[model samples]
Target chain A: MARPDNARYQETHEWGRLEKDGTVTIGITDFAVDQLNDLTFVDLPEKGDKVTRGEAFGEIESVKAVSDLISPVSGKIVAVNDGVDGDDFSALKKDAFGAGWLIKVKPDNAKELDKAKSLADYEKQLAEEAH
Target chain B: MQETPLRAEHERLGARMVDFAGWYMPVTYTNIMEEHRRVRTKVGLFDVSHMGRYWFSGRDHIKFIDKLVTNDRAGMKPGQIRYSLMLNGQGGALDDVLVYGAGDDATMLVVNAGNRPKIWDWIQRQRKGFVVDVTDMSTDYAMIALQGPESANLLNKVSEVDTKALKYYRFTRGTVFGEPEVLVSRTGYTGEDGFELIMPQAKAAYFWRELLNVGESLGAGPAGLGARDTLRLEAGMPLYGHELEEHINPLEAGLDWAVKLEKEDFIGKDATVAIKAKGLEHRLVGLNIAGKRIPRQGQDVLRDGKKVGTIASGTKSPWLDEIIATAFVPANMAEVGMSFQLEFPGKGTRTMKPEEMRQTALVVPMPFYKRPGKK
Candidate 1:
């Protein structure tokens, strides 16, 4: 999945693409969706709500089990992409990079981005996980 | 404690392996929901070799097992099948099983995976005076279940043997995939119409590959124990350990129909009679997700802030799009349309009323999802 150069990934399989405007576009990674099976209901965070790093923002209710969506960065929910709520689950399969985007956040601090994994590092990390 | 012939196949498919009744088995392949949705909408392949099979022979064998099981096996013709239970001396279930009257003296008992040894011993003890030979064919045999609406068509293609004559709960033994020792039974754990194929252990992999190849056009997936649990739960069927055990009687588990009170004799009849006169305390019933989360087995059942019983098996119903569970509730609360509260994560106590009534799960029996008739 393609992303902005400045974005980072969480080891738990969530990705955050930090836009130039200091807002970050967030969604669970492709690996997370596969691990979760068919996505049935995604509870997106309300726009303007606040979430903390490593805390649950909402939940993604898969048919088999429900998993909490954690915020990779502490921030106020600036906007949530309506695509997931719009029922284009094929996005998670087709254009998971762009159209499958979940929520956007204005990070509390720019340096907090350092806590995430780089693209090359995340790929190698996923490789190690594959082994 | 032994794994099925598909252990390597399961691992290759990235199945999440767990110890079920001591046998290391795959609980899921890919994801449970993925497999479950595929089964509901399409077809699913199941490796069911873990179940135990016993063949009974001798003239008295018919009378022997008929007295043991609750089903009216004495009246069954060859190729006919019946679902029944083996009761203990006190009328409690030894195990819920499928009995096939292969011939006048030829009877077969398919038992649960966990209770093979115990049930085998029970059968031996009962055979003290009867002139019969009981052979444990489980180790030598393997079983596969092709479940879902399309399963029948897929299985029919693999074998030229007549299937149109076969109705529900009937069996016919013949060759499948060039293997001569095949028995196709019109039965399954999944609610969908399907067939269970039994073959020798050595020929299992061959049959597996054949089924996958032919069933590919039918949209069959290698379903694991996880999706099997979800599918069976949706059907409101009982799991041996969770929904049934020696400590619990069939009456409480809503298996009273399997108890033949008029039978000349069987284990557990006397106990069941006594218990029936005394009345039942708890009734096993289906509980729709009382809250945001699903109820798991062994979780305490509550009524009026007091403990009543406990949950046995549960899952989030893909069809219902809600958490659903089966629990043992007080006999009174078990009535159709009864309401109760269940504790869930974040959501403390939530009271939800059952949407239906109990009648073969038709009323409040909690089928949870309405389904069309099979092809």
Candidate 2:
């Protein structure tokens, strides 16, 4: 469950990385992937769908339950991961930082401080918590 | 939170522990879906040692039990076990359990782990006459459910008793793994052909390890609670806390078959009869989610725009690879091929397909499922 070098993380365990033209790629972190395993189906929003921060944009169906995929940042869905459909879901853990990227988003605020924090910062936040 | 004796073993296996009904139990080992798949495709062992055990004794034990539980204990043979529910005077379920008559004077009752204290209190209150001494022996005993495809074969390797002659729902009490163990019933909460081995606390871990070793060449693996839920869901079985609770009666939950109206008398018998005569408005039904989304407990079940029922339990079947759910709907919606929309809390609403739902789920008919034979 190690953090990848290129991706930044949200407090909600989402990882994101900005592309060349400022389009951001977003997906859940490795820790999140490990937490919700054996995903049978994913309900992602349409490519042009609008999402708000703290709102659920989709759902993930595991064996015992279906949990919501809460949006970590307000954005417009530009592209969903091509591999999320059918049975090509290897990236959810294998290359979670890259191919597992859920969608490309144009943030509501281009200059907004991304919710993603550094790896050490994320680890520190979890460490301070009372589990 | 309380810990079972197998808590150490679960932790050692890298299980993800969760707080289940005030007990710290393993929710999964690798992951719920993978564990679910493992059990369906091959074998999965489960450490269900936390479940409660009660021993009813004395000369009138059979009479006491016949008047205690909702099942028809009068006709129940010595070696046969029956799934039954202990009900309150109001017909509300106190706890569901498996009843195995060790002897006419001694009968063993395996109750849910969480409801041990409640059921014991109820038992003490009910045992007034008939010379039955109710004893709570849960702490002294441990139970292991060796479920899935290869359970019978694996048990045959170690036990002296002839398990092949032992039919389903039957048990043969004898020595097992060098312990004073009772291997009478192949009944378990999981929907599989499996045997539940009961023993004293001292010899439990050794038997569990030995079973794992015994099933090694046959591809048997230790399963967690994750797969158990999925297997039961796939077979359209009801969970106690979710589907059958203190506020829920067996009749309303579609478990009236467990309650015998022909019996002389039992706890909640009159109330069950009254409820049956007056009829029930809400009844539990199985759901096959139309879309990919799964509906979990506490979620609302809707139709058109009306609130119909609430989801009691839900899971994605690893065998079928579809979302399965149990919900208590109105009598009208309880029928097969009745389409309803479900609004999952936190997750958006999805319309359930009526034809697909009915084809996928039945009314939890008799036996529910005929488990795949191990040997």
Candidate 3:
């Protein structure tokens, strides 16, 4: 998959893209989706729910198992994606980086984005893990 | 990890291999959801060579087997398959198995791969006085199951057997893909019209690829253990470790049809009769999740304010589009429409009482989804 150059990734397989409006959009990475087999249901936080970085904010269930969706950036949830809570799961598998963006948060600390891994670094980590 | 005859074939098809019961088996060829849906609607092939296949011969084989299992096999004709249970002295399950009467003096027993060694040892230890020649044919044969509604037509195209004429629970020896001596049995664990083929180990890969080639036009795909589990669960079939165990009796597991109490005597007959007379303490009941959360095994089931049972098997049903589970609870509380609280995370804290728990599951009928025809 073509990784977006501007998107930053967390070690736990979540990706965060900082928008021009100072809010960050978060979604699970394509690798996470592949590892999960097939995404059946995703539970997302309601609007205005506070999300902390490195903590579980919601959960994603696949056909075989369930996993926690870890937050990449800490902030108050400003907006949520309808697809996450809805029945259509194609977004999570097909357009994970774009239409599948799960939640948007107004960052508590803007400097935290620097700590996230770049697209190249994230791909390298995935390659090493596969070996 | 031990490998089946089709292990390389599974890897060639990009299967996700896992360590299942000490064997490296395919968990899924494509994705579990797609494979599961395909089998329910169409046809799918499963490589079940890892399951133990044992053969008993000699003049006293039938009598010897009748003394060992709970099912009545005295009237079983040649080329007939009977599902039965091997139990200990306490009526606890040793393993659930399928017995096939090959001829007047010979029989075959197919058992779970995980319980193969234990069942084999148990059978051998019990055969001291009987004049039966026991042989472990597990390593000598390969087993494959073609399951679903389209299985018969798809199999008829590749095999010499007239599968359409074969009745349910019937078997016959025939040629499949030019390989002779294949035991084609019209039986399956999936609640659909299907057949199982047992043949030589050397012909497994050849037949596996050939069957897929012939059935490709019919939308028959290679399914793995993942799809197998969901299909059986939807069929209300009890898995060995999940619904049965060394302590769980056939009566409580709802397998009374296979337990012949009216027969003269067999292993565990005395205890099973006693248990039947006294009634059951815990009954295996189906639980349908009222919410989207999955009911995981070993999760606490609460009634009122106390834990009443634990979940045995659960999965998200692709066919029903709902979460379903099987659990053992008090017989009185196992009635239909009875409600129980499932310990789902984020529903509430543990200190919350039963009524306070936000998420609840209802006791529903088993076989969350049934196929069109009756078995």
Candidate 4:
């Protein structure tokens, strides 16, 4: 799927979207999910946990390897996605952008999202990586 | 990086290639779980050309081989294959190998890809008094494994050799897909019935494509090394660097059956006998953890809050959907139903207590998933 046009992305393939209520919704991109094929477990932070920008807040384990889920913006996690947290991964596998949002964070500073790449820039980075 | 004969075919199939033991090989075509299940229930093809294949001949072929490996070669019938471990003088394993007894004058030794150079040098150094001609034919042939429950049916459809007549651990030369002189062996690392075919390197691409073409209707597909590892782990097979290491003897690794102590003195025979007499300090045991988080290699195994063992190999089994692992613990603690704690790497120094980072691991029987109705 085309990365949602409004979402800001990190080089590590995480995407975050800013809402009118000033909370940011975060989830991993399709590319990251594809690379981590056959995911067996996903460990996410609980609600009210503090997350720092450009640091690992959780982990994702596939059949072969384990990778970190980096945060794009520092914030306190206000809500965790119960739909994709535990043994069930149907939401994350079905629509990674829409229903698969991992956490909702109330950012320390909304301007921190400015450091992330735009949708076009993220696609450009992905294109260059293909070569 | 070294390339296999079927490298181009793997690329065409959209395989995710990675550097494995200095050779560029496919890790997965689609996904590891899908390929793993395919091998368990149906059939899957694997390009194992990267492994070292050495052909031996001459007057002392059997004598030289019998003196180098742990398994008995004197009683091996023609066309039979035996799994053996080549060891150092200290009884430490050099490499686990498959000894193929072709005939009175010929033998073939297949070694792991990573240990090819070391094994080759060891053989050369050890053959001072024996008259054996060893030829390294790893690059000259392509080894393909057709594995699963439906493998025999698939082989009978494409090859002239009658799959029904081939007994387990036996090999035969036959024509496959109009390609003559193909060596078809009914042996595999997977716990299911399967065949490993050795063919000329030049015709590897043709045979790979043809096999998929004909076997596709029988639910056959291409698998990669990722699936190969999980399948072998579930089968309780000892990988070279993991379960069978340079410092780990066959007895400590639960491979006592393959080590023939009564046979004539081979390399490490004296040390092996001494080890048996001294009894085992630590023994390899299987662990079943009750969670999704896998216990990785080198992780600490604990008993009553004290570190006592280490994980050798572990995976979230695709077939059983459970976290199965192999570990080495004190021989007294290796019994089934014995429980221990597996210390997982804590997440970012957020330690609550010792018990928080540890998960309970139970000692279980090996070969966690056995193919039903097969020996």
lDDT tens string, model 1, B1-375?
589987777777777677889888877787777787778877888899999999999878988987788777888888999888888876677799999888686989999999998999889888988999999999789899988888878877888667788899999987788777589999988777889999989988878777878888889888988788888888878889888888788888888777788888777778888888899887888776533445557877666767777888767776566667788887777887776666543210111123211111101565555457642
Model 2 per-residue lDDT tens digits across residues A1-131? 55666666677777677678777777887766766776766666677888776778776666555666777568888887768642356878687776687878888864442555777887777666414
After superposition, the stretches of candidate 2 with alpha carbons farther than 4 Å from their true spots are A5-8, A18-23, A46-50, A75-78, A85-88, A108-117, A124-131, B59-61, B128-131, B182-184, B343-369, B372-375
TM-score on alpha carbons, each prediction = 0.75, 0.86, 0.87, 0.93
True interface contacts reproduced by each model, as a fraction?
0.10, 0.33, 0.18, 0.24
Tell me the lDDT of model 1 at B225: 81
Worst window of 10 by summed lDDT in candidate 3 chain B: B347-356
Interface root mean square deviation of every model, in Å?
6.9, 4.5, 6.2, 4.1
Any runs in candidate 3 off by more than 4 Å, and if so which? A4-12, A16-25, A46-54, A72-79, A104-131, B347-357
Model 4: residues >4 Å from true position, as ranges? A114-131, B345-357
Q: Candidate 3 DockQ category?
A: incorrect
- Model 4 lDDT at residue B282: 89
Q: For candidate 3, lDDT tens digit of each residue in B1-375?
A: 688999889989988788899898999888888898888888999999999999999878889899889997877988889999999999999999999988686899999999988998899899987888999999889999999888988988987898767899999989888888799999888787889999899989998998899998889999999889888898899999989999999999999999999888889999998988898999899988866667777888998859999888988887887888999998888899999988655411222234423468899988887887674
lDDT of 4 by residue, B258-283 (tens): 99998977999999899889998889
Give me the chain B TM-score of candidate 4. 0.97
Worst 10 residues of 4 chain B by lDDT: B346-355
The model with the greatest TM-score is 4
The predicted structure with the larger lDDT, 1 or 3, is 3
Cα misplacement distance, residue A129 of candidate 1 (Å): 13
Candidate 3 local lDDT, residue B342: 83
